[model samples]
Target: MTHSSDLLPPPGDESAGALRVQNLDLNLLKTFNAVYAEKHVGRAALRLGITQPSVSHALGRLRLLFHDALFVRTGGGVEPTPRAQRLAASIDRSLAILQAVLDEGAQFSPATSRRTFRLYMSDFAESAFLPTLLRELDGRAPGVVIETLHIEENQFNVAIESGRIDFAMGNFPHAFSHFHHCELLQERYVLMMPRRVAERYALDDHFVLDSTVPPALQFIAVSSHPQSTALLEQHGLASRVRVAVPNFMVVPAILYRCDYALILPRTVARAFAPLGEMAAFEIANASTWPVNAYWHRRFDADPGHRWLRALLIELFRIGTREPHESWLAIPPNLRPSALNP
Candidate 1:
């Protein structure tokens, strides 16, 4: 009887020119990655620019090469076998390396590259980064499209591991060992309220915390992560939650409709201050949120990935410097106001 390892080729096993010399085809590995990503052979076929029959043939080869069903059909969809699940991460990394090599000489001119970047970010990050990033992309990569997936902090690792998201940028205190990280920006918390409230109470005046208080401030809590929720508790303000929400994009619109105070990053509050409907004041707490760019280690060396990340870093750098309202726990006369404000 032959052992399983005997039938399998070792890592990086390949002949110079013959596909038959090795039982596995590198092209089939690409097909496998697509099918695993889509979970449907038809969609995988379209992604690989091949016919459905060809995809099926590739899947058949993959199954025989590994001597496992690889994908088992159930409930009108297919699920990866245990072996296939184990092979997934390495296969994705390998394919990326292979593709990078095949196109090593190509230029990564963002202006001409029509690619869609799927980014995972919390609504808070989106509110802070989107406006400036969009403007820059319009002038740089006009045809590059962006799609965002709202990520709860805990779901970040799984999202990046599955190759479903290219990057996750958010304010979370996470140390992901499997991916690369860069600090895009750091912001302190601010208390934003309507103009009337700012006038009624001084920044130093201590306010009582209560659940029954009328909705004096529209507190926009980002519902996706415990970290955002934890900020208030860590600062002894958990009982002050009057409004619970999930997206920062909707905060401005909601604040425009009512008088509400929310705890947000100074940068974020500043970005929305120009809307002409609200004001922002700095909270005394020294808590900070760090915006990070996270990508899988597999793509760390890929030229295209590097180019896109560099552009994003530049965009974030320029956007965070915009002048706006300053919320500080001090008298207005002592604060340095924005030059334009």
Candidate 2:
């Protein structure tokens, strides 16, 4: 929808001509983009480092200019109208292009520049990787900020394309040829049990499914990823699964408090092992999956994005040895590193 009045003369002048492109303020469009991204005035203001009143003022101008209520207040937050959604694609692309052009010659210095990098990752990755990465950033890039968002598998590609998420880290089956990716690590499934259970059962480096253990031990199944459950079923351990949880983060506590054992990724199990209550054991047969860092190809040459990519690669580079501390009492060879170089 076009703005009703392109050119504004004196106030209350019905003869005012149409507005021209030259008269538009790019800052207002930028504000609109922020609001569109966050869908809340307060959050958008925080994102843009502006005041809520300013954001509200910008939205008002946008509504008047477009002759449409671009957004409406909702119980949870602001919801974009259909017109806003239609305008968003072009507006976002235009702003991105303008941003790219402006950043063409600008050098990115992480140490001094206050740049916020957003990433989409699962809780497993957060538990495994954030400590080391944050430590590195504290020393090398004091002014840089890092924000992690939960990965919604269905919208992963769209989030990256829209610049809502700078990087996505996980094992995704679909190939995004239009995006750039670097393998961060490869992981296989492992059975994690409380230290007491491991010691009581005399389970060493690997757990062997047997008549003595299969029926007696309770299995904790994660509903988010069924691959692990499927593996258990293939191994005829499906009947043992008594506790089903929606997320892997809850597995550690569940196993610690109960006699249940969890089937999880090796890296995730290792991350939980250091809590001093859990121990990881190799599964009888499990397939490995690669965890990768994905980003839009449009940012391949961006200085800031390039720096961020390098930082992630450096911190998560495939290593010959998994971090020794992830395993509680497991032997060195049995302990898999989170990343493989």
Candidate 3:
């Protein structure tokens, strides 16, 4: 089989003449960087808000330009070839320098820039912040588009480190250290049930006891968290999950007309409360989860990235305090600070 190096056009070949003689399309470098950063064409496409086919097309062009496969699929998604790996450091440096030059020129304006900013978030984030954020962006930054991307915890750090993503906000696991993080806020987990159901039965058994509270009352769960199960067992309630939904949105959507109770974060509950008439109660055994914003150091000095980060911080501020500080202020219903505070 012919390897990538063998595919390089000859020094004087007509195909190589144009790229050598004239202006090279620097956009190709962005494509190359994305591929290198994500190590997967599919993910790079999502990051760039393009199609997998487009990423593949870009890779084909990059392969011809560099005469290297650049990346080859492996047991762990796609891995860069030796030539591509060797080019990474230099390519990153070049990209950073280019971004620096662009930043120096007053070309990017968040208010007028028609750029799409991509974010990685959890389902809870999607439910809590995305709608308001989109409306705000539309009314203010008419040209901006917000793209929410899905993240896999196992591969997330590598993707973040490579500059495949501009920023990500969520309850990221603690082991990821390759990127810089800003504490966005902390939110408490709560119990959600239709107000009617909550009124009919007092929460006397503790948050966890509802599991075996008779199958007459069902339980809806955010399937990913281990705490959901533990919370049930803690109250000596055998939580027999009648329905397990993957996202917070789905939990409330399903519970609206039914008697099922859900365990979720308060931020999520408030967002969906009006739609479902769902009421939230502090989960006695639940602890708050920290939410953070993260970015690769590569974009730390880029003006556009700086602007975007600042905008997010501004919007999340509450009560004249930053989101991080305001998390301590309990909502009116749960105003008494906990001993944990």
Task: Count clashes in each candidate, considering only residues at least 3 apart in sequence or on different chains.
Answer: 6, 10, 1
Better of 1 and 3 by lDDT: 3
Ranked by TM-score, top first: 2, 3, 1
Off by over 4 Å in 2: 1-104, 209-214, 319-341
How high is each candidate's TM-score? 0.56, 0.63, 0.60
Candidate 1, which ten residues in sequence have the lowest lDDT sum? 322-331
Query: Over the stretch 1-341, how does candidate 2's per-residue lDDT look in tens digits?
Result: 53323322346666445657886899889998998999899999999999999998888787767666788888877989899999999999999898877876576888887889998877677777777777778889999998998755788878899999899888777747878888887777877777778778777655555334645777888888799889778777888888888888777667757888877887777767655466666666577878888899988878899998998887786744444442223435554432221
Model 3 lDDT per residue over 73-181, tens place: 7776688889888988887899899888867664467677787888888777666667667766777788988887776788788768776677887777753676787
User: Residue 243 in model 2: shift from native, Å?
Assistant: 1.2
Higher-ranked by lDDT: 2 or 3: 2
Candidate 1 residue lDDT tens string, 232-340: 6665556767678765667777777766677766666666666544555544444665678888988777666788889777656433444333321223443333212
For TM-score, candidate 1 versus 3, the one ahead is 3
